[model samples]
Target: MQESDGPAPTSFPRPPNLLDGSRTSLRQILWALVFALTLPAVLIATAGFRSGYRAERETSDRRLQETARALSLSLDREIEKNEMVLRVLALSPAIAQGDFAAFHRQAREVGLASQSRIALIDMDGRVLLNTRTTYGAPLPDNWRESVLRKMQETHKAQLSDLHADPITGQALITIDLPVVIDAKVAYILSAAIGPEIFQRIIADQRVDRDWNAAVLDRSGRIVARSRSPAEFIGQLANPNIRDASAMSPEGNVQSVTLDGISVRAYFSKSPAYGWTFVVSVPVTELAASFQRSLFWLFILVGCILLGVLLAAILSRLIAKPVDRLVAAAQALGTGREVTGTTTRVLEFDTIQKALADAASDIRAQERHREEALARIAESEARLRLALHACHLGSWEYTPSTGAFEASSQCRAHFGQGPDGPFCYDDLIAGIHPEDRARQAEAVAQALDIRSGLEVEFRVVQPDHGERWIRISGRVRSGTDGDLSLVGVSQDITEQRLADERQGLLLHELNHRVKNTLATVQSVATMTRRAAEQGDEGAWDAFMGRVQGLAKTHDLLTATQWQGASLEDVLRSELDPYQDAMRQRIRLRGPRVNLQPGAVLALGLAIHELATNATKYGSLTLPEGRVSVMWAVALSLSPPVLIVEWVESGGPPVTPPRRQGFGTRLIQRGLAQQLGGEIKLDFQPEGIRCVITFPVKAVLAEPAPAEDSAERYAS
Candidate 1:
């Protein structure tokens, strides 16, 4: 279905209704009532029958389990009593002393005096004496080792399952008790009894007529069967009993297939012997009672359904006015009102009249909404005009729903789809990565505080490539009780580029100003020192220093205040003096790129240091050496620019209290402009000035290899 902006248009004709007014169709109403009433009744009856059957099956299983438990407990008591009796007899002094002859006579009088079969066996399980003449033969293999091991290790009574005697072939269980003398096993007293003695106890149980009970041995083999013949004995039932026997010796039920029919098996285990007793009953038989219960349940359900049908018919007659009111309200929701659709049913007809009134009220509200939409359209038009003038576009975002909408210029700014406005995510993706994190953080903080955010960031445009834009946004509470972000964005590309160009020009101007200051300082130093000289010997030296200063300033002017090469400055300044001599100088340092401020400061400082050396230090003699080397010390507290103007093989040097303008300029002027500490040491050896400054303040450029060689050659 197409989502209509408002109510649907009523262009199509309405379909004709067969039943109208009070003359409703009897056939249709009757059919609808019958289906509504009987469909649920039938389903409920079926569900009730299933629930009853399951409940009965579970109850029957519980009953059978109870019967198995009772049988297992009774059997345990009987076996325990017999085993206890034998154990007590085995501990007799006559038996523990291995006085088998005395034990045999006493065993016959005490144990075998009745129908019980008793015997006295040695530690090796050799039947040395027997009360019954039937057990006169040697012990069998099955009983001999078991009896000996029980006496030696456990020193407790062991009750064996019903087994056929080797000699008499009589079914009996043997109870063997160990005789311990001074904590050492000496003999075993054995007693055999008919299994019918234990069966009599199980047969006396008052179990249900359908339930059959049986006692199982330690290995899950049936030892005794009640309500059945011996044919069913010595057989295993469900394996769940055997599996649970080692862990849990208690009553439980298991599902099994018995006699080709599914049956629930209930079982219990003997705590004394680790044997499981199981009882199984057919589920079909158990469900008989539930089947009879469902019969009455269906009858009760039918009567209730008949009453509900009559009630539905009466309720429909009574609720005619309510139905009309509901229909009237539905019409209003669809932007239509039904007039005079009222009834005479007391309370219901009053509601119908209210619905008619409500429909009228809705039409008034709709007119107001239409008028508001008109005003919104006008405002939006004016906003668009203003946005166009400023090259700006507006947008709104609802964070709770992640919904967003933007204007035409916003999409054009980021080069998004022309037909559709740019999504908020698309706009975010256009932000430059360097500035995206800060812009995103500002947006998030504004959303949290319900305030406004204004930020500028670079946007990757489609046709124009990268352009900077300023976004202004405010978070407001919307009508839906959720925060909505509404914002406007304007392109600031040209303004940002203008700012960058202005910054570059200012930087260049600052470099030119500093270089000009250095030239003035050099010219002043040359004139002052020339006037102070007392001899013509110093006049050439003063002219050379002025030339070095002029050479460095020429390099600065050529670069237009941007930067200059350190090697070019050094070679130009030294060439005038070096051309007359066939001598050389060595210069070494990193090819450093410098800013304009550092360029002028170092140029003048190097000129002064070299001039002083040529006058009175190493450069005064032809055999003297002038090595100019500069390096960047990265491991300093702050990185520093270090230049060494070492003069060797000349007259001895001494410290001077009064410094010339040249010395003062290299110490204070360089230190002040470069923002670093400077030290000038005038030792007897040479003049060493170490300058420590931040890397930013140094004006350095890569020194050409040819320029460095020329400094030495000339």
Candidate 2:
């Protein structure tokens, strides 16, 4: 081996300074760039603005005019919808048969959501049935003489202007349709809608806050308004509104509003009726665009100053990130790992990560080389360490010289101290007397055939105890041309124990399956006899029994037959009728686990009890309730689990005239399988069942210390 030499030093190239003193300042460059880009745009916009002033005025007015047109169309559709509803109500068969009471109920349902009401008025303007009031109750005289005259003249659905309700005195718009009986107008069916319905429509259209929107009838009266609708409704609109609408039906004009403010008004008249929708804005808004060019001239000078200020701020921000980047580069050159840092700049972050990754890759390569050499030159101590890690013992023998070598683990496998001397005599003495002779024969046979040796045997440890061991070996030639046997041994005592337990479990499973099949056969025979004697429910009863047994078996299988929860057994039988609200049936108990046999018996009994309750006990009545409670009686000589079921608020209970299959199963099966006592009482109030079983026989977890053999046995 050669001695180490000191590390050599090397120099790296330095980067040239990019920020030289002779270069232009970044602030001057930024100002030049901004000035060049914005100069032409500023000039062009300023010249165009003065020439386009008149056009802008027309556009503003036209936009308002279009908004008014759209609002007018929306208002027309709402009135049309109300008219259709009124016409449908007029055609109802109930009204034609003089059954106004029935018609009123139908109208109330249609208008329930809108707060609108329907009224039947005769030709004499007398209010008949009104949905707003109960049938046969006194109604206000709300008939309008003008509305009736107009309806009689048209004989079709028509919309009325704003009117006050006689009872509530609130403004309402009436949609009226006449009922024609035998070629004569007999009655008017009117649906009264509040003015707020139209006000909502204007607000929904997103009219400007500074603007005013209104709906006007043929007389130019305001029916609805966007701003201050309650105060303006039913008042006459601006005088110019009627004059301009009469001439063009839709146009923009200048007028003074009721508040004495000068406004530019735009109106659209509905083609169906003479109703007009008017949208108005202040006159000053139209003239505000004339000074926009002057505003831009001032902005142009401020942008030049802002450009210089921003450039200085940005340069300071970039300087710190540049310093960090330089430090990272120097660290990489010095063969030290580069520490990661964030500057929140994309280009700088990418370069810093690249330098860090290069440093990491170099370190990984050197570490891999060192580890590979170490594994190649591993010594005997390393081999012993590996053997101990895997819980295996190493052994070697030279048949030609009768030499034996063993690792510390091999000494410990025989209950000897790890540092104790172990030879051929010690190895032979450790094997059980019964297995020593057979193991010797196996080794001799393998040597004669020049093959491998594999054998399992029991070893008697002086201090530890007896344990199972398995060894395997193959013959090889040593450096001296002598035959050597090298092998490894592992203690498999736990594996052997598991195999014995599996065998006993198989035997127990076989016995249990046979008993279950016998139970199934007995139930089937009983069900078939009943069916042949004309019992319609015999098959259902048999299936229910089989399903109940399957539920218990599933519960046991989930726990590998260790035990089943008693609450789970009860739920399986009563889950169909279970109520989380605890209104009808209630189950209360302490946590108790039951053995497989007890689980099956208790589950079946609960199933029968629940079925009987559903058919003839508390479950048959809405108010009936059943309470099932259970607890462990630890004070008894042998602790016992007691369960009780009581029913109340049900019909009187009576004992059966003859014993049924379910009754017999609950009475006999629970006692036989659980070795418990059961009492079933059928009192006048309800049926009550009590069950008692030894806790030691049924509990899965609270058992005394048991021998290993007994635990594994059936």
Candidate 3:
């Protein structure tokens, strides 16, 4: 019997077209236009509503800013006027000269006119005159001494914040005016203004609605408030209020929730008192008009959208079944077998027959299943190869049996032998002793918390070598509470070694450069001291000594500071005068390295001898020449390098009468650093100097360049 290659079917019948396809085209077009118009209308309406709301908010913010600025300016003017009044009182002839009767009479007249309390206070805190009493009351003892100290020290008018006066039992702000008599402060005239006046000014500035204005002292205590004066007048500052006051001096507006209602607030600082003033309006009230406008807009748009959606649903009921049948036929053409059964409409019945025929035609040509399987296998094989090349490995854990199986690459990463048992303990044993405990702890933490794992540590290779390995894993948990850890690890030994070498080289280079800078600073200091103590001749001699030290460094750098080669050193110092000799410079030596200190001293000695030869010795005339050579001692207990400088070309040579700084520096400097001796030759042909130094450092192996690849890969 032949197997059937047909799809089993459900009880859906093929649908028929209720309306002709040609007749319904115009209806579909009309409905499509309807949906398209409604979508844009909704988006445009939303955009328009937001724009209108933003404009309203901007206008409100501008009005609030303008009002706040005007109020602040007016307050500044009033405070300044009061300051001027106190200044007039301070300079009164009677007050400065201590004519008590005239000062008292003037104070009373001015107090009544200004409706303020005034008093005269001397440096000793004595009240000499009072405006409000039959007999003058003594100055209050509770007033801050800093205010008085300021007045006497600055000799200027000062303003104080509102405070409760113990003497008068009323809240008052005082202005202290300094009385300067012949450059000495005689007294301060104090004017105590009532707190009520400040309150009235704040009240006039208040906008209707739930708005408030309050002034806070430098210590953040409320001195006056526009709303509910007695409730918060002397209270400690609110947390949000205090922080805002400290940050800003210019007035600002913000929103905060107070009493569960979000409030929009404006704040400013008083230049006169270092005081912060805050005004707040309820955000709910400010945005009420905006919310109402948005509410009507949304209602209108929502009604229109609802009507369109209803009409679309009716059209979908008739068109949906036909769409399904057409889709089934298209699916068959694309090599997807369709059951070809639908009952959405009558026209779809015809579609069912067409789809079945196409399905058969397509089946004859399709090799989709076989091709798909082959492609999948090829992709997986390529993936495996790539993972092996890069040394990457994957793992899976079965929580059901608490069994963990890692890939072959993972086993290799841990340095496990090829046919050995692969388990967690074997992996742990491969970790370097120093890093073993850390890696173990990380793994344990991951397992305990049922979380992911990541770790890097050195692995002790089987050959007694070490390699760095990085391991990462994730936990798999079963529904029954069992958990298994799975992860991967790869070798990173080469990278780790490169990083370590790079770090070491950087440290060594920094240390050497710092030492050179310190040496230069010391030379500058000694030269300056010498010049300070000596005459022109002494200063010039000191400068010449410093220049000779600098010359050594220049020669060392020319050799890349790798170490000086003896023959290269001689030619560097002697080549300057080669034009005079025309053909008289000769050098012979095998390459040898010198320490930086040894190279510097030897270069200086060569420079000094060359200078002498050029000026007054053999090289003074045209026929002078120098021969330099060195030979290494291979048989000595410790190796030694010997260099000889022989000059023979122009004039006769002689030793100097007095040993100069250059002579002493070269002979003494080389002997001190190299533990060697220098012999100066005053030959008839030219001047020659010989230097002998141990090769203790030169015989040691030179340090190789460190690998830096780890840095780039990281």
Maximum-lDDT candidate: 2
What is the alpha-carbon lDDT for the whole of candidate 3? Answer: 0.66
Q: 467-498 in candidate 2: lDDT tens per residue? A: 99888889888788888889988888999999
Worst 10 residues of 3 by lDDT: 705-714
- Candidate 1 residue spans exceeding 4 A from truth: 1-52, 91-116, 124-143, 235-262, 305-714
The TM-score between candidate 2 and the true structure equals 0.44
Candidate 3 has which clashing residue pairs, if any?
Answer: 15-345, 15-346, 16-345, 16-346, 16-347, 17-346, 17-347, 623-649, 624-649, 624-650
Candidate 3: TM-score?
A: 0.37
Question: For each candidate, what TM-score against the reference?
Answer: 0.34, 0.44, 0.37
Best by TM-score: 2
440-538 per-residue lDDT for model 3 (tens digits)? 798788888878898898888788888888888898776777777766667787788899989987897788688666655654565565467553454
In the range 1-714, model 1's lDDT, one tens digit per residue, is 997699867785543221233543334555567678777877887887778778876776677767778677766656655554454355345664656666656566443224567776767656777777533455553356855875577555777876778888776678887765544666677788775765666666654556556677777766766656477565665576567665676655556532344555677786557667767666677667876887878787777778767866776675666567656654544433335543433444344444665657678879989999999999988977888888888888887898888877888777787686456788788888798998889889998877888998888766648988888988889777999888898888889889998999899778766857666666566556656764354456556555655666677778765667656666666555563543546655546656655666676677777777777777787777776665554433354555656666678888776767576666655777778677666656566565666766774543333223112211
Model 1 lDDT on a 0 to 1 scale: 0.66
C-alpha lDDT of residue 299 in model 2: 78
Candidate 3 — which residues are off by over 4 angstroms? 1-409, 417-421, 432-441, 466-468, 476-486, 492-585, 607-625, 633-640, 648-654, 695-714
Report the C-alpha displacement of residue 100, candidate 1, in angstroms: 7.5
